[model samples]
Target chain A: MADEVILLDFPLSAFGMRVRIALAEKGVKYEYREEADFMKRIKSDLLLKMNPVHKKIPVLIHNGKPVCESLIIVQYIDEVWKDKSPWLPSDPYQRAQARFWTDFADKKIYGDSRSVWSTKGEEREAFLENFKVLEAELGDKPFFVSDTFGFADIALVTFYGWFYSIKTFGQFSIEAECPTIVAWAKRCMQRESIARTLPD
Target chain B: MADEVILLDFPLSAFGMRVRIALAEKGVKYEYREEADFMKRIKSDLLLKMNPVHKKIPVLIHNGKPVCESLIIVQYIDEVWKDKSPWLPSDPYQRAQARFWTDFADKKIYGDSRSVWSTKGEEREAFLENFKVLEAELGDKPFFVSDTFGFADIALVTFYGWFYSIKTFGQFSIEAECPTIVAWAKRCMQRESIARTLPD
Candidate 1:
C-alpha cells in the first residue's frame, strides 16, 4: 500500500474510472477520495492547488504532486510501476503504435461518439461513419494491440463504458456497424480489473 | 550506420518536420521517401499499403513495421534511442506533465491554431484566442519545460511552423499578439537540431 498515492475521483467519470482500473491492475493501493460535490464544494482544496487550470476530476495526487489527464495519468502509472504489470509495451516501436491508437480513440472516437449522444439526422450519420472507421481499423483483432491488453485496450474499453449510456446500444448499434470492435470491447471488459471499474 | 529505418514523410508537412527534427536531434540515420502529390497520386499503391486508414505521413518504418503519427514517431525515436539523448523526462510525474502539455498542444493549441489558416473571420479570432491560452499558460517560462526543451517544446515548435503558412500570422502578428510564445519559439528554433529542420 502506497500512502503517497491519492486519487481524487468519482466512479461515474470515464476519466476517473480509467485511472482506477490502472491502479487496480498495477495492484497499487492508494487512498480513494470521492469528490461528491464538485459543482458545490469544489471538492478538495488540495486538488484545486494541484491543478489550477482545468481543475477537473481524475486528478492523481501522488507524493504531493498532482497529475491531470486520464491517458497521461495512465502513462505515468505505467512508467512508475514498470516493475509491476506493464500497461505499455517495452519495445519503443510497439509503444508508439499503442500511443497512436490510444490518441486515435481519444480524438476521433471519443469526440464523435459523444456527438452521437446529443445529435440526430446527418450528425448522427456522421457519428456512425466515425464509428465505422474505428471498426474497420479494429477488424478481427481481439485487442487493439494484437493479443495483449495494453494501454490502448484500456483506453478503448474506458470509452466503451460510454456505449451503454449512448444510443450505441440501441440506435447506433455497435454489433451491426462495428461487430468486431464490439466483441473486442466485450473481451477487454472480461478482465477483472476492467470489469470492476466500469461505470453504472 | 544503420540503414534499416525508413521514414514515409513529406518535407512540406508540419508533422513530417517534427519527425525530421527528432531524428536530427537523436542523430538517428534513416532513409526518407516522400509521398508524391497527394490528390493525383492517390492511386499509388505504396502509401495505401503503408498507411491504410488515415493515409497520413510521418510514418516511421522500423524493421518493416510502420508507425504513424508525428508524436508517436517522436516517442518511438526517444524510446529506441533512450540512452543517446532523452527528449522526455524519466520521472513518471514529470513525464505525465510533459504528456499533459503535449496533448494540450495537440488538442487545443495546434487544433484551434488551424483556424487561422481557414479564410479569416470569427474563426481566425477564435484561433488567436486559443493561442492566447497557450501564451498565458507559458507566461514567463523560457521553455514550456522551463529550462530544457522536451516533448511539449517539439509539439509547439512544429505548430509554429504551421503558423507561417496561415494568414493568422499577418492578422494577429506573433511579435505583438503573443511575444512570449514567439520568443520561446525563436529560442527553441535556435537549437542546432531545431534550426536545421524548421521551414524557411
Candidate 2:
C-alpha cells in the first residue's frame, strides 16, 4: 500500500522547514498544507485534531497518525525512509552527537535568534553573543557534523531564509559576524532538497 | 575492555534522576558523582569540560565522552545497551510517539511544574490546569506508552518526587487533580530502578 504522508506547516516557520527538508531528502512525496492564517493565531481544525497537545504546525501525518515536534518528525521521516538519504549518522555515539547539536540549534540558535528579533540594546547584544558560540561550533566545517549535510545541518539551515529578516530586525550582519556559518548555509542550499524546501 | 560510565548530577534534580533510572534499568554499573554545590552555582571542572554548552548537571560520561540533556542521555544509554531492556519501542512509529510524549513531558510538564513551583495566583492556577491535560493523556494506560514502562514514563516519573514540592508551593493536590496520573506514577515507583533512583 502507498503511504499517505501530509505535513501541516506555516511557510516561514524554521520548524516546518526542517520537516520539509527531511521529507525532500528522502524523496518522499507528501501533501504540504500551509496554515493560511497561522500568524493571525487561527489554527486549522485538522492541525488542532492532529496535534491536540501542541496545537502547532509542522505536524507530519503518516497514514493518519500525527507526529508533533520538528526534530521528532524529521527522525520519523528518516526512519521510515532509511533506504534513501540518511539524516542521522549510523554510529550511536555520532547519532547522539548529531542529536546534541540539533538540540543545541533548536534551543540556542533558534531561541537566541528569536530573542535577538524581539529585544533591543543589551538584551539583544547578549543574544547576538550566543550566535558567536554557534559560529565557533561551526568553525570551518562544511556542515555542523563535519563534511556531511546531516541532521544538524537540516536543523540549522532552515533558518537561513530568515537570516535576512533576522539581520534587518536585529540590525546585525550574520555574514560579518559568522562568515563561515553563512558559507556553510549557502553550501547546504546547493542541495535540491534544502534549496527547494527552505523558504526564499 | 570494560566500559567506564559516569553520571555527574545533583541529588534532588529530577533531570539527574532520569539518567539514574535509565542506567539502573539496564543494570549498568557506574560512578554516581553528586554535585554537592550545584545549587550554590559552583560547577565542577569535569562538568564544565564535559558539557561546556549547557554546563549543567546530569552529564552522562560513557568512556570519557559526554552526552548531556537527560532524555538524550537516556536514549544514548538505551542504544548502547540495546541487548538489555529496551527503553525505546522497536517500531519507528511507536518510537516517535514515545519521543513526542517525552518531549511533551520535557517541555510542558517540566516547564509547567517549575512555573507552578515558582509562581502564585492565576499563573499557578494555569500551570496546575496543565496537569489535567496530562491526566487525560494518561487515561487508563498502565504507563505513558500503554502497558510497558518506556522513555515517556522515565521522562515523567522523575518528576514524581517533585510533585510534593509543587503541590505544597502551588497549593494543589495532584491526587485530587489527576488521580490516575498519581496512580501511574506509583506503579512506576514499584520498579527497583525507579524506587532506588527517584529522589525521596
RMSD of each: 3.7, 1.8
lDDT per residue as tens, model 2, A78-176 = 888989768777788888888998888878877666567665578677776766777888887778765678988888887788678767767877778
The DockQ score of candidate 2 comes to 0.79
- Residue B6 of candidate 2: its Cα lDDT? 89
Name the 10 consecutive residues with the lowest summed lDDT in model 2 chain B.
B111-120
> Candidate 2 vs. truth: CA RMSD?
1.8
lDDT tens string, model 2, B2-120?
Answer: 99998999888888989898999998999999753655877888888888888899899999888999988988999999888687777899989889889888778877665676546
Q: List the candidate 2 regions with Cα displacement exceeding 4 Å.
A: B118-120
Best by lDDT: 2
> DockQ of candidate 1?
0.66
- In model 1, the runs with Cα more than 4 Å from the true position are A33-49, A115-142, A165-170, A176-179, B36-44, B117-142, B162-170
Per residue, candidate 1 scores C-alpha lDDT tens digits across B107-141 of: 77767755766676888777777678678878888
Give the fraction of native contacts in model 2.
0.76
